[model samples]
Target: MNARSLTLRNVNKSYDGVHMAADDVSLDIKAGEFVSFLGPSGSGKTTTLMMIAGFQHPTSGEIRLGERAIDNLPPHKRNIGMVFQNYALFPHMTIADNVAFPLRMRGVSKPEKERRSREALAKVGLQGFEKRIPSELSGGQQQRVALARALVFEPDIILLDEPLGALDKALREHMQVELKRIHKDLGVTMVYVTHDQTEAMTMSDRIAVFNQGRIEQIGTPDEIYFAPKTRFVASFIGDSNIIEASALGDGRFETAVGVVEARATGAERNSRADLLLRPEMIRIADAAQPDRRPFKIDTTINYGDNLLVIGKLGTQAIRMRVPGVDARRLTGSSECHVTWRSEDIHVIA
Candidate 1:
């Protein structure tokens, strides 16, 4: 199979001139890479996927698969495989027939079609269930059958629009691993669309975060988690304590909690900024470490696997996550000291 690189340039879409779906979006995807478009509902991720799959035409700009322009090409002529939120399987056909449908449409020989169908089912760990109808299979099994059908065509790229949306949490997590393995083994370009952050973080090589019909940031999981570019990105990706602070001219911040040392970059000195601190960065102060900042623990919550310690400093309350193993040590009243290093602070103006 020939793997193709996809590129979108200044792609825009709108419906009824009131809903601006995608706004001036441009992205480049490498061959044999798994990329996900991730965002909440109405963020234009699905619209962008539809445009790339040739199901919906962009209002402007162009789409290129390698050197060939595919903006005007029909959906079938694009040679792309697609899996939707719904399985969309034929209830009347067995799993084998469903997988072989694509090959038959392309006029492959009956023997070759059967061979490919069985091989595709085996690839998805559904080898012996090909004789069962869609109605006879579980939700997860039906979803796997749809995936097998998509792969049986041997398309250059596959578009998956929340393909695991219907499964339970545990099953969806398992399928994420399966999809990653399949992508690596097949070496086919895959563009996945999902609003679930955990699923995107677990499966994608890189993710493009969408908001308000625009892409806010595109990076690996760590980059997006630790080095968010905007305030929106910082707040949306994970839980963070965003506190307003004043840059005290020399890598120091005057915050509501207290004056603390922090790292500052790409922002002017003495400017107003927001400090983002993850819950795990703060730690309880030790008496042996006398130089650590002091804090007063206000509340402690047992979260099964970890203890969430809420503390008060001046008028502000901060949260810290402590391991369950160490939770037994914090059995005292609401009065514990806490501290954090200077490097854990993320400053966004």
Candidate 2:
């Protein structure tokens, strides 16, 4: 199958003629790549997905599928497959018929439709459940059927809008793996939209983080987590402690805790900046170098795999994640020093 690229150029959508739902959003989704749109509600990810699916028209700018400008095309004419959070299956129809619906609508013959429907079902591990109705299947099974339906017509691209939101946590996690496997096997260009950070982190080749109708950053999972471009992207993608500080030049910053070293390549001296600290990067002072500063340990929470220690660092509350073994060694210590390498401190512009 030939996968086609999707492009949005300066796309903007506004309701009530003033506020923009998607502001100057430009993205190029490469053919056969899995990219995820991750953000909170009303962040314009869904609106952007709708525009790509031809369900919502952009107020201005261009949308192209491969070489053709598709901004004016109807949803049906675009030939894109879409999966919704609600499954959107025909409850009255058998699983086979539902999977064959798209092919039927395109005037496929009965024999070919049946063959393709069964083939799609087999892809989703639902080959034997074809005769059953949507009501007779479990949530995960129904979701698989929905995926089968979306893929039955062999679309050039597939758009999934929170397709796993309705399932339970364990089942949702299971489906994440399934989706990754399916994407790998089919090599179809897919654009997934979800509010779940873990889902995006686990399944996407790259992630586009959205905030307030604009894309804050777009990068690989590690880049988005360890090197966020903006404060919003840092706080949204994972747990982060953002500290306000003034740059002291020479890759250093002055904070309440003390003067700390950080990566501030482009930041000017004496300018205001924010430092991003991931809890896991900070180590207990005892386990690290002895020169690190000591802080009063206020409390600790046990998470089985790791211990989350919350404490005060020069009047500012901070958090550190210690490995279980290291946490056990400091069980009775009220004051423990914590330290992180200069490279671990991300100075957000």
Candidate 3:
């Protein structure tokens, strides 16, 4: 299939013509790139995707697939593939027939439809199950059928809206791998809409984080995790330690940890801001270190491989993640010396 780039220029949508659901959203998705739209509920991620798919027309702005304008095109006229969260399969039809439904609609010959449907099923690792009905398959199998149906038509692009939301944890993880492999094989431009941060971080080549009807930041996983542009991005994507601080000039900040050094990208001289410190970035320090501060342990939660220790770092509440092997050191102790590297601190003004 030929891949096409997707672009949205100043797209805006409003239900009551007052508050915007998608406020001046503009983005350019490269051809054959895997981009995930990640955000919480009602954050405009799905609203923008629906506009791209032509399910909901934008109140303003232009949408294009390649250089052709598709702002006014209907859903069927765009020839785009879509997979929903519920599978949306025909319960009474055979699996093969269901997969071939799109081809049949386009007036394809019986032999051609059968051949394409079988190929699509094979791509999703569902070969030899064409004769089975929907009820005869498991949740994951049904999802595969939906994907085959979407791909059998060889549309310009594929869009998935929380497609793995219905599966269990193990199955969801399995499908994530399968979906990545299929994308690699076909090199199809996929726009995946998901609220799960881990899913987006694991599967996407780039991620667009949406919040409050706009994209907060768009970048690779490492950039988004380490150099977030806003406080919301820092707090929402993963475990973060947002600490209040005042810049002391020359990349130094007077924080609760006592005049810590950090990357001063967002901090200005003599200005107050917040610093983001990831839990895993901190570690236990050596005893009798004069510069080291004691982290008062108030609670500890074991996560099998790691331990989350909640404590007070000099009257400022903070959290730290340490290896499970260190849990023994904090068994009966209420305090421990802790320290972090200067480069790991990110300023969020």
* TM-score of model 1 (CA atoms): 0.94
Position 230, candidate 3: lDDT: 93
The digit string of per-residue lDDT tens for model 3 on 188-239 reads: 8999999999999999999999998999999998999998989999999999
Cα lDDT, model 2, residue 95: 96
Off by over 4 Å in 3: 264-266, 288-290
Q: How many residue pairs clash in each candidate at the backbone level?
A: 0, 1, 0
Candidates 1 and 3 compared: the better one by lDDT is 3
Q: Which runs in model 1 stand beyond 4 Å of their true positions?
A: 294-300
For residues 218-309, write the lDDT of model 2, one tens digit per residue.
99999999999998998888888889998888998999888989874677889998899999998876555855888798899999889988
Q: Pick the candidate with the highest TM-score.
A: 3
**TM, every model:** 0.94, 0.97, 0.98
Clash count, predicted structure 3? 0
* lDDT scores of the candidates, listed in order: 0.88, 0.92, 0.92
> Model 3 compared with the native: what TM-score?
0.98
Please write out the lDDT profile of model 1 over residues 67-138, one tens digit for every residue. 889999999889899998899999999999999999988999999999999999998899999799999999
